[model samples]
Every structure is written in structure tokens, then in C-alpha cells.
Target: MITRTFSHLVLALIVFIWIVPFVALVSTSLRSETEAKTSGFWTAFTPTVLGHRFSTHDKGSTVEFIEMSGNIFDRLNGEKSGFLVSGEVQSILIKARIMNPDKPGKTKLIRKLVPAGEPFETRGGSLVFQSNGDFTWTFPEATAPKPKKLDVFINQDPIFGADAYIEVLFDNKNVPNALISSFIVTIPATIIPITIAAFAAYAFAWMQFPGRDWLFVLVVSLMVVPTQLAFLPILQGFSGIASWATALNAWLTDCEINDSCQVASKSFPSLWITHTAFGLPLAIYLLRNYIVGLPKELLQSARIDGASHLQIFTRIIIPLSVPALASFSIFQFLWVWNDLIVALYIGPNNASDLVFPIRLQKQLGTFKDQLHLLNASAVISMIVPVIVFLSMQRYFIRGLLAGSVKGG
Candidate 1:
């Protein structure tokens, strides 16, 4: 009992530590930039109050409260600008003006800093509010012939401070296009490498050929080389090829050489090829290890029954090796999806061929003022990988464990 309890405690601690950062990341993505800027990412759990920040933008004690949540908590035209309702403000949205820091200006628009559970009341309006967000606004019979009366209900979210995700979605307009481009770059890069690696891995594992071990060693050796070193040469080669293709096209067809012969200069093809080359070594190594351990009895029996190599490979090996394939597919998918450096070097800064990571890098470098977007963008990038992992996590773990056992 003691041992089991201790083990459970340790596991819970490990899980908590592992999960904290992801929770923080999610909170940051859903946070308003103003709130994130003032407090920090983690404070999205308990967002800070801006404290009825709206002041006179148009002038007069009657400040126009921008309509929010079908409840416009405007200031009454009176001696002092006081809140309209009393009771703990569960949460609210109203436009308020603050001193502009950018240049000479009286006030700039900002959200009201009224966080949920903060107490508030209109002293002049003779109003009282409760913690449940119910408020009663009243006026003396002298102020109005028939006494003015009002009640307001505010919705409360105990977990989140504000509906910042909605605001963030509307604010960042390029997210949809970036997401599409990321898929385009990631899917092909993943499929091409895995398909090619499976063929090569099977050959190395099962077939006997001259210099086979040496060749496998050489391929594995290439994995150690940094992707940076190869970029210059690949870029130059593709440029040369594009130029040749352009010249040939002009000669063969009616198109001018200088005209848009869009064959090169940071394109989809360049990214696909770059990712393929980078991912191939690891894919081959992983699949080869897994394939070698697969039961030799199955192979021998198939061979005795006169089944050809291609038939056996396709019909037998592939069907059984699904776990290893899935494992590597996840790895390559996440790597290509999350990669920034390869995209930076091979992909042009232009949006036409820009992958998601490259686009995010541009946002980070070019728009320093919109720094809060980094968290949102990072969360978007992880969506596909998270889904893939959650769905195939069992296969991924099984493949790794199977491949790590004693070699055939």
C-alpha cells in the first residue's frame, strides 16, 4: 500500500509539472493583449481589473458607454461620472478612454478594467449591487417625476477573466491563410519522406547487397550535419535550374525569358525537397530498426510459398509495420510543421510560398508591437500535432518500444 501510494504521488507530481506549461500557453493565447501586457501570461486565470477606465472622449458628464453584452453601463448626465449599477460586477465590457502614450492626445479607447467579483456602486444614482452581478439603479422622486428604476445581470466565468479568444481571433486577420500554408508545407513534406524512407529501410533490413552496411552508415552520418550548411548550395542549385528552365522555355515556346517563369526563388517545391532531405536520415534509421526485428518466420514461410519480394513487402511487411510508420510519420509531421530555419532559408519572405513557421517568424521580427500574437500563433501551430499525437499516441509508444528491443 505504501509503495503504490508513493508511486501514485510521484506520477501525479510529474503529470502536474508536465501539464503546467501547456495550461499557461493556452491561457496566454486566450488573454487580451492589454491584460497580458500589464500582468503576464499566467494571470489570464485572474485577469487584472482596469477599474472603469472610460473617461470623457466626446465631453460632458454623460460618457457614452460603448454597447457590450446587450448591457450598456453608461454614466448618467450628472455632477460626477459615477457607475450606473451596484453589486459585484461579475464581469463587463465597455469602452473607456485613457491618456494616449503614443503622441499628444487627451484619451484613447480601452476596455473597462472591471473584473468579476469587484464591488461597485453609483453613489449619486442611489444604486446598490450584489456579488451575483444583480444591480438596482434608482433615483430620488425629485430627480424624475416617476422614479427611474433599472436592473442588470452580468454573466460570470470563474475560470477565465474575459472572452479574449474572440477578441484575439478578430484582431489577427492573417491566421486563416497562415494555417492553410502551414498544412500545404507540412503534409507533402511528411508523406514524401516517410514513403521513401520505408522503401529504403526495408531494403537495408531484409535485402543483401554489396556495400549495404557502408551505405546505411553513410546515410546515418548525414543526420549529424546541420541544415544551415546545405541551404546555400541548394538555393544556388535551384536558382541555376530555374534559370536554365526559363531559357529553355523562351527558346522552345513564345514566352520571354525575363517574363514570370515562376520556376524558382523560395517556392513550394523547394520547401518540400528541403524537408525531405533533412528528415530522410532519421526516418530510415527508425524504420530499419523496427523492420529488422519483425518475425523472420513470416518471411521464410512466404518465400517457401513462392511469394515475390515486392508481394511480401507490400502485403506482409507494410501491413504489420503500421506502428513504426505511424511513429515516424508523427515525428516528421511535427518537425516539418514546427520548423522555422529551413523555411527561412528556402522560403522567401513573401506570403505566396511562406509556411506557417516562417510567417510567424516574420510577425515576431517585423511587428514587435504585436508581441502578444506570438502566444496565439504558437498555439495554432500545435493544434494538428496535438490531435495527431492524441489519436496515435499508443502506436507511437509501441513502435519505439518494439524497435528498442534486441536486434535481429
Candidate 2:
């Protein structure tokens, strides 16, 4: 029991360690850029710190007082010899420099505290008064003071923790459009490979033909190839395809009466193709193994019923292979959703065609000072994957565990 409790504590600690950064990330994202820079996210949650920092009335140690200087008051013989004191300060600290007629080179400071509700009298060359921050400087004598003017600067000390509302701003309008573009690129990229691989996997598992096993081996072996080698060649090929497509688009635009052609030289379709090509090997490998393990009796029963291959696949295999399909779909979706390299190669880097991943990265270079925006964009980018995984997690686990154990 003790061991079990210790193990749980360890697990909880690990989970907490993993969770803190994300909590910080979320907190950072929720604040305005100015707020995020001054303090960390954890500070927002602590009531003690908040109360100490932003409370206007609290004279706590954590609070920083701001010093404000008022207008220089010139005390003359005929002048009222008074100036208005600002703010709700209980006490005023004054520094007054007076020119001495006796010693022309010497200046004297007549500094004193004038507590609230008492009038400040000018002593030689100084004045002090205090109020609920409305004090007036007065020279008791009618003659001009030794110094030409007495300048007073006031300081207001403030406490922290007043603002409870933190607005997480994702004001970059480009992000939502880029997210839509990512979805456009990802959903099709995920679905197309799965659809194509499912057929190939079904054939590899169920159909017998010349070189069939060899082909399955070849397909599986391709998964071993590092994607870096193919990236440049694939990009080159996509550029050529895009060039041709652009030519066709230009022709269509020229032929049209209303010539508002917003055709891109490259776009989401190319990204989908690149992602699908890169993702297919894994899809086929996982799906083939799962399909191969499905009972042969079911395929035989379907065959005996005169069901066509396509019909059997659509009606029988797909329904039963939901777990495997879902697993691969999640994998491909996340891969394409988060990929910046393939999207960069195949799609235009401009805002018109950039995906969310690329959009978030653009903030680093083009708008690095917008730290809050980057955090918010990152959080926004993560939402779909989180939702996808959460919704399909059961199927993902079931798929992994499907052939792990057998009763027979």
C-alpha cells in the first residue's frame, strides 16, 4: 500500500511537472503583451501577490511609488505665495533651494513635512503644507524670497493587485484564416492517404498475386527512408506542377470577362499532396498489419456472398477497421497540422496561403516583440489537435491493443 501510494505521488508529480509549463503558457496567452512582460503567469493566481502588487490603497512593500513633480512656484512679495498640492498624499516631502542675498553663491534647502490639515509657512526660503492631497504653498512675508522660485515634486506610492481581468488577445487576424488553411490542408491530407492506403493494405492482407508479398515488403521498407533526402526533389516537382497550374489559371483568367483571378502560384492542394505522400508508408504499414490480423473467415464469408472487392471494402472492412483507421487518421492529421517544412515548400509563404503553424512561426521573425500573440497563436494551434486526440483517444488505444492479446 505504501509503495502504491508512493508510485501515485510520483505519477502526480510528473503530471504536475508536465502541466506547469502549459498552465504558464495559457496564462501568458490570456494576458495583454504589457502585462505578460512585467510578471509571470503564476503571479496571477496567487492572491497574496496580486493583493500586494495592484492594490491602490495598500502600502505594501511590493508596491512601487511613482514620483510626480508639480509646477515651480515663484514666491514674490505681492503674489499669493501659494500653490496647489496634488493627490491624496498624507505627507509631503519638499526640497526648496533659496538664493542667499548675504552669500550670493550659497543655496539653502528649507525642506520639511507639512502634515494634512495644516498650512505650510515659508521659513526663510521654504514652504510646507499637507491635506488629503490638496495643500497650498504660502510665503508668510510680503517680500520676494531669496530664491526666485520654489519647485516642489510630489510622489504617490501605489499598491498592486487591483486588476483581476486579464484579456488574452489573439488580435492577429491572419491566424484564424491560417487555421482554416491548415484545416483545409490537413483534413484532406489525412483522409486521402488513409483512403488510398486502406485499399493497398486490404489488397496486401487479403489478396494473393504475383510479387504481392514483395510489394508489401517494398512498401514497408520505404518507411525506413529518411524524409530529408526526398524533400528537395519533392519541392522541385511541386514547383513544376505549380508552374503548370499557374499557366492554366492565367489562361482561364485571360479568357474570363471579369478578370479578378486570385489564383496562387502554389497552395493547399500541393501541401496536401506532399503530406499525403510522406504519410502513406506509415498508414499502409499500420493498416496492413491490422487488416492482416482480421479473421480470414469474414473475408471468405463476404466473398461467398458475391460481394465485390469494392463493396466488401466499403461495407465490411471499413466499418470493422474503424479503430485502425481512426488511429492513422489522428497520426496524419497531427503530422500535417503541425508541419511547417512541407507547407513552406509547397505553399506560398505569404499570408494568403500560409497555414497556422507557419503563421505562428512568422511571429518569431516578423513580429517577435508580440510575445503574447505568439503564445495565443500557439494555444490556438494546439486546440484542434487536443480536440482530435481527446475525441478519438479511445479508438487509438483500442487500435494499438487490438492484436496484442488473443483468447484463442
Name the best candidate (by lDDT).
1
Task: List, residue by residue over 194-278, the lDDT tens digit for candidate 1.
Answer: 9999999889999999999999999989999988888889989878988888778777876664576555667778889889999
Q: Write model 2 residue lDDT over 1-408, tens digit each, in one string.
A: 999999999999999998998887777676544446656676645421110111112223342222211222111112422212123334444456878777889987767654545544444423433433333334434433232232323332222221111222244467667877888888899989999999998888788799998888888789888777888787777667766766687776673556543445467777777788889988888888888788889889989999999998999889988998998888898988998877776776777668987887777886576566667777878889999999999999787666234212
Q: Which stretches of candidate 1 lie over 4 Å from their true place?
A: 1-17, 46-49, 55-173, 365-372
TM-score per candidate, chains pooled: 0.72, 0.68
lDDT (C-alpha) at residue 379 in model 2: 81
